[model samples]
Target chain A: MKQAKYGLLLYIFLALPPVASLMESVMIVHMHMQLTLLVLSGFLMGTFFKQRFASFFNNWNQSGVPGVILAVVIWAYWMIPRIMDETLTMHSIEIFKYISLPFLVGVPLRDSWKKVSYTVKHILYIFMTINFIVMGWIYVAINQQICNNYLLVEQRTLGFGSFAFAACMIIYGFIWIFSERKEHQQSS
Target chain B: MEQTIKETIRYPKKLLGVNPNDAKVSLAYLSVAFISLLIGGLLGLVQGLERAGLIELPSWLNYYQVLTAHGLLLLVVFTATFTVGYQFANLSHSFGGLLPKVRTLAWVGFYLMIIGVGMVVTMIVLNEASVLYTFYPPLAAHPIFYVGLVFVVLGIWACCLGVFINYRHWRKNHPGQVTPLLAFFAMGVFVLWFFASIGVTIEVLTLIPWSMGLVETTNVMVARTLFWWFGHTLVNIWYLVATSAWYVIVPKIIGGRHFSDKLIRLVVILLVILNIPGGFHHQIIDPAISQSIKFLHVFMSLSIAVPSLMTAFAMFAVFERTGRKLGGKGWLGWLKKLPWGDVRFLAPMMAMLAFIPGGAGGIVNTSNQLNQVIHNTMWVVGHFHITVGISVVLTFFGICYWLVPYLSKRKLTPKMNKLGVIQTIIWTVGMMLMSTSMHIVGLMGDPRRTSDTTYGGHEVAASWIPYEMVFAIAATLLLIGVIIQVYAVFHMMFLSPKGQTEFPVAEPEEHAPVAPLWTERWGLWTVLLLAVIAMAYVVPIVDMIMNAPPGSPPIRTW
Candidate 1:
């Protein structure tokens, strides 16, 4: 319980202009720290709510499919270079980034991940993998600046990151399918 | 039917037989690796201090010479020897024992590697090979250096061949059973190493003759291209060996069951296929390669990160399952329940954590456009320090804690155990300081591989001095950690009280009788691996050869 409270306080503290400004000044930290840490803070807060909202979560995400989908959508939104740029330029978007990541994405992911079937989880992974590949292709292929604030080079670097992420997903899918098939063959 | 099931479940004691000769060989390899690590680490500190302008080099030891020694000893000697020794232990324990012939060959390989390392070191110390570890020619080394490196590669190949023979014998006896996970991982690493070495082998064989003045000139671009081909794959081999520890060894110490054996095998197979060809990412900025080939290489490099990502997910899942079983509740609760105090578990876990940023930096590195900004900068130095330095080296240290004791039949003293923990903490803190500063300074346009950052007191270079100062301090911390670790390892091997300890093996969550047959198809996988390599290299190599320039004769810059 204390951990949850501390997490919330930490989230609020990080949201302060001084801290946020310092973090967002650096390109790598903006992505790795400000954004990623925001999600982690949300995750920590979600643990306290798990018991309290058990019935509500179970009713909405019994199979965990909806929650997983929502979380993925939220995550995919943030991966966009344009969205990242908006956080720097627009104040409202920055606030949204702070609030939505934890409550909407991180919280729901925690609730739904356990409820989802292994098959469904893998299917979700495939979708995420494709998402990364497409994002990477867009980032690398486009010569024009995707983000108003970041340099063209920074945008392209983000593209490579997307490619790496997608690659990992595809590899995971390959391994998952192979392993499952082997199990089915032997069991039958 | 019941008896067959019982036999399957029974522990295979025959496979765990202890051989004094094998132990001696393993110890010898480890000793060399440690010695290399200590020397390499000191050289790194010297380089860091030089970069900061805090120290003057004695006339005998130039900056480039120290750089070459640092890169060669740590990246090649320490990593290669430790991996071979660690894998030998794994194979011997899992297979019961290596055949006497195989054991004899392994010793021969060990001696050959030692001889090779000695020659390379001698040349570097004599200022005969200041070309840096890349040995990117036109800046040539003494012929002995190239020959010595070739000897090292051949020695590793011989050791790998022994592992393959042992696996074949095991398969012949077990019939339908899947290769045990550790053995499977060991085989995958060796196979990958074998194929990857082909490019370097060609490069070295050609370079040796050229360096000896047997040939008038050498193709500089072609040599570099081939070196990158061997280079990236070599890093992956190091990564795979560390991953093997994460998969097979870490789980046991933490009381976690193995993730599905099939999944683990699949990851290994995927690595075997994707680990090569990605080397083009290193050459993306080079002039000779076409844009299309470079782009394709970027994709391939991106793809290789997949297996590593899979490892992260699978490892986390294993931890979650174990923690839940031990009464951990909530989303992040499992993290706390882990045996954080145990150096064996803590060190590797921390290494995995470091890989998140390290791996992310790798993506930035592979970006063709982005490479123009950060390439050959301190950022790259920071990137690899996290990836290969902290992640790979620290994990190997964790393995040694238990492995040394297991092989030596000696127990780690409480004092040494305390020091081991301190070593890991200090290493983590030191790397954080050094790499963070390096990354930031790199973005400020600080060049790497240069002895001095202050280019005639230019404003830009002057601004980087503070970061360089931070790096020097970090190096000091790292040196202290290295000393403690070396002392601990030495004491555990020689002075610690003797006791028997079992090689830890985690049971799978669920038992499956028949192993997956497709995973065992090594010949097919090898063919696939070669085909991918061809797709990546054949066009580029052909292009370079067709439009050949007059090769350059050796230049001795120092």
Candidate 2:
């Protein structure tokens, strides 16, 4: 956890300083390169780091079949830009996500019927908390603002829809935590 | 407590459980919603007549009024009715018995809502409250409209109260055991609407009253804020209850056990939290709020996709596993093996079908740049028709097919029995054609509210006339489907049976070929948890630093 935090902080520090000008273009490009690597690292951590962080990954795996798919999907969605051209329309990408969703969601439901253990659920909560905390900090640092598109006004924010949905998930998280605690107390 | 019929009438010794009651109440609410749908259908017929110039249309039943009534009635009232009923039904089962007082209150609440809807319809017909039913400023309706609306909100408040009481009762009775999945979701939506009601309640009780000259100095911004509070969360309430019903019904139809009950509960909780604060998404376009706030809202709105995605996953997984276990071979071959004739399977099945177009349209509607071209256009109408209209109405029909026999205690006559599935296919196919045409018409610069054939000084061309004609034709098909439903349900309910009825009890039947392994453990929670994380990553920051403060001045954009 500490190492992850440090790595993120270092990436932020390298990315934030506005030192580059026409004379320092190389350095600016280097900074961009480093920032990309950090995002990549986070993506990997959110996705494949389960192999190395067995306990954490196992706990996360327990969050639910849906959560596991979501984590993978999010990671994959973020990395799409890195791997693909920037010119692709968001609509098309959205379509891709839509098509992929049924398959991703369906895959996990086939194998098991066991309830996600409480310990894994909480561990997932912790991981999500970290991810959000990091993303929130990035949003703050970058001075996030809504685009000037007409849809922005009528639709709310581009990301707000997703965010609102996520908030509902958080509410679920707390409910689970409390329920698990109560169950533990009863058993004890 | 009310001893009126305590002695003479014998209440059943055993109350139905969450699953059965969930089916009953959901179907009952759906039954009502579909009946009300005929009203909307009648309105659509009028629209077709007016558009074709076949009959002179009333000024009050102009495009905007009809559209608003249709939108709010089907999405809000119908959705809310089904949600409230589902909540109570689940409660009845989860609590191990009915809370008679709460049950009675729910019934009264249902009647109150009916009265309110009746009043709204009357006002629309009489040309009394014809300002277009939206939460925007400078348009006012009749005092009766406002009063009737108050009754509507009060009815919802009553329903919410019933849910709370029932949930508390259940918690009291069942100490250590996990709450019923459906009941747990009901509680979540119940909590959501408790807060949801505050905003709309204030708007209906205070702002509209003041606007109607019943009071002075009502805050428009305040009213707008409040309406959206109820408005947006109301969608969540719909999704939550429907999803709960989906969880119960879908697995059963496909011959599958729930992969993870706990995960589904978690998803319900996520839906509640995510759906509430996200109401500000509607305010994104207004200059009254800051650009940053809009950005924040966008993020939250997008985060909602995660759990929705989770639902997609769980549903497919459940169906897949069911299919595989029921002696189905191969990966996708199970799709063919699943039962399609069962009415119970049709309800949740239709919801999945409607979800495809509805969810896609939702993304387009929410996109910042895309909104400019489509906002207030026929495209906007088409989008919601796909989302709210398709999902809710299809589910309504589906629930009917599932529960009519159970509730009516009679076999649907062969004709009546088959009507449900046929009507469903007709409605689904008809809506796709209608909505798709509407979207194309919108893109061709057809404004939504105008009642004339002229746009920007040019009459619609002969080529364009085909789409318009198609819209009317499709509406007729939809009406036929609705009529068939009404005919079938009324016949089944009134003429079917009075004594205990018996039918074949269905076992779990799988639809999808393979079930994902993780569903049992974390399927629902994982999707919901990620969604929450995504939203939390965005909302507070924007609320605090980016969006205008809550009481900021209003800025107008059409």
- Which candidate ranks first by lDDT, i.e. highest? 1
CAPRI verdict (incorrect, acceptable, medium, high) for model 1: incorrect
DockQ of 1: 0.02
Candidate 2 steric clashes: 67
On residues B1-558, what C-alpha lDDT tens digit does candidate 2 reach at each position? 557465312332345522344345545675676676677676776676565455675543466567657665666666677666555655664555566677667777888888888887677666666655564444566667777777887788788788766655555344555555666676677767776776677677764555555464545554665666677677767777667667776676666676565456657666765765566666555445545445546766776777887888888887787788787788797776677876556756777777877777766766667766777678876776666656766765665554555555666555655777788788877788788888898888676766666444455644456677777887888888868877776676567754443222222333522322222222244345444433332333333334444332222221
What are the per-residue Cα lDDT tens digits for candidate 2 across A1-188? 55445544543454343521211122211222332344443432332333355574456446465555464455445432222222123557434433333223222321112345546555555665555444434333433232222122222322343335445556656755655345445546
lDDT of 1 at B443: 94
Candidate 1 lDDT, A16-82, residue by residue in tens: 8888886676443466447767877777788787879988887888888888888888988887777
lDDT of 2 at B485: 74
> If scored against the real structure, what TM-score would every candidate get?
0.74, 0.68
TM-score of chain A of 1: 0.78
**Winning candidate number (TM-score):** 1
Q: TM for chain B in all models? A: 0.96, 0.83
